[model samples]
Target: MDEQRKKGLEKMNEVYGWEMPNIEGDPYFDLTVDHLFGSIWTRPGLSMRDKRLLTLAAVTAQGRQDLGEVQVNAALFNEEFTEEELKEVAIFLTQYVGFPLGSGLNGTVSKVVAKRRKAAEKGAGEDKRANVNAAVKMNTGTSLDDE
Candidate 1:
């Protein structure tokens, strides 16, 4: 990766919670990281989460379920959206995007939601144990809800 694409890939992976795959020798993939992610996505006017939501809308409207898979997974893993809110967005998009396209996108979102929630719940349990251990050494009682 070139310097700019490397930095863009790192930041995007951080936000998405997964390393986006690079296509070796593909100029298009290079351009995606260099231009779309590095330049356009880093614009100060809109937050990353907001940009993901808008991208979801655009992808759904165009019936691009493949891209939707990545965006929805990013949104869920990043906690940019709650499951209910994501479902609501799908329903809302039905009018503008049509039922077939919106429903297609929602199917991908639902799959990612389940997977992300399962991983998060497991991590939460481990985190609670660590917090409890720390609190014990400090002689301070900590409630799970306090976090």
Candidate 2:
């Protein structure tokens, strides 16, 4: 990756708590990262959570649900806003933004939340299995590292 894009991706990952998607091959990724993220998103004035929320409202207002998905998922993964807080934002925004747009945003948020919850459950199951294996090993008198 180019230095600017790399820096932008790094900063985005730091803020979003997950790796950004397809930035390497995306043609417009540079514009978004270099201009949008590098210049605007990296600003110190607004916290990332605030930025995410603002972006959420702006994108949702424009009916850009496709783009909104990334912002929505990132907001959840970053733990910047609770689902309830997002719902409240939806309520207030709908007063100005219209019900259809708000409803679309709500659907997008629900999908992202469900996806994250499923992933968490899967990870928890894997952790449970690991702990059980460890316990069995301990009961049989050998540490996992011993063999």
Candidate 3:
């Protein structure tokens, strides 16, 4: 198993207080997570904004707001999408996903934005107090939340 998948499963287990039964019995497990998200998502062609928009649509259509919220945070905080960009994605989602989903999307986006911005400011203050020179060199090229 890839460490990424292992770590994801670990987190799930920790949260739910039980290991999610392995879906390896189903052959699509590896292909879905590994080939799709792991490989295709990491490719350079799609911008993070596009990915987040896609994720928002998919999650809303499928009624998976928890996952969507995480992706929203990844896009806004980790991928450095501006507030306008995030709003655009949420607005666009309404066309295919409907108004109710759009409202949930708005709430999810707002919640993540507030939480992440506060966390970032706190981290910055902590870094400043610690005199961590590396904090000054922000690597904005990629998502930092996953690692």
Candidate 4:
């Protein structure tokens, strides 16, 4: 793999807390890995947590609960935001984005939190990465190609 793609995959894996394979020959995936993630997300100024908050707000404003779930799962898995903090984010965004959109986000946050709690309780010794990968896959589908 090229250096930029390799760097992007590494960054993407770090951000999502999972191993993401490179999807060669797909323009969308190429742009995502080589540009969006490689260039934009790797930029120095904003922390991943800060970028996540911005992403959550943007997706929530669009009422994209499906996307919100992915973000919430990754954020929680990465320990960038606590469950309580996510709840607060839902409440905070509700004011500016309106009740419906906010409620959608709230629901997504609650669902992810509950799932993580269940996983933890179910297998105290289980690998946390497995649970997170499962959650991310469930929310995002098998791959970008599937979308």
TM-score of each prediction: 0.71, 0.72, 0.55, 0.85
Best by TM-score: 4
Residue lDDT tens for model 1, 1-147:
678877777766665565455445556656666777777777799887788889989989999786776677667667898778888889999889899998987798787666657768887522334323332222224333454
Overall lDDT per candidate, in order of appearance: 0.70, 0.68, 0.56, 0.83
Evaluate residue 19 in candidate 1 and report its C-alpha lDDT on the 0 to 100 scale. 48
Candidate closer to the true structure by lDDT (higher is better), 1 or 2: 1
Better of 1 and 3 by lDDT: 1
Weakest 10 consecutive residues, lDDT, candidate 2? 125-134
Count residue pairs with overlapping backbones in model 2.
0
lDDT tens string, model 3, 1-147?
A: 767666545443332223343345334544444454455656688775566567678887777777666566556544557767777777887887888887787788888777757868887421221111211112122122322
Q: Please report the TM-score between candidate 2 and the true structure.
A: 0.72
Indicate whether candidate 1 or candidate 4 has the larger lDDT: 4
* Model 4 bad stretches (over 4 Å): 124-147
Candidate 1 lDDT score at position 74: 65
Candidate 4, clashing residue pairs? none
Top-lDDT candidate index: 4
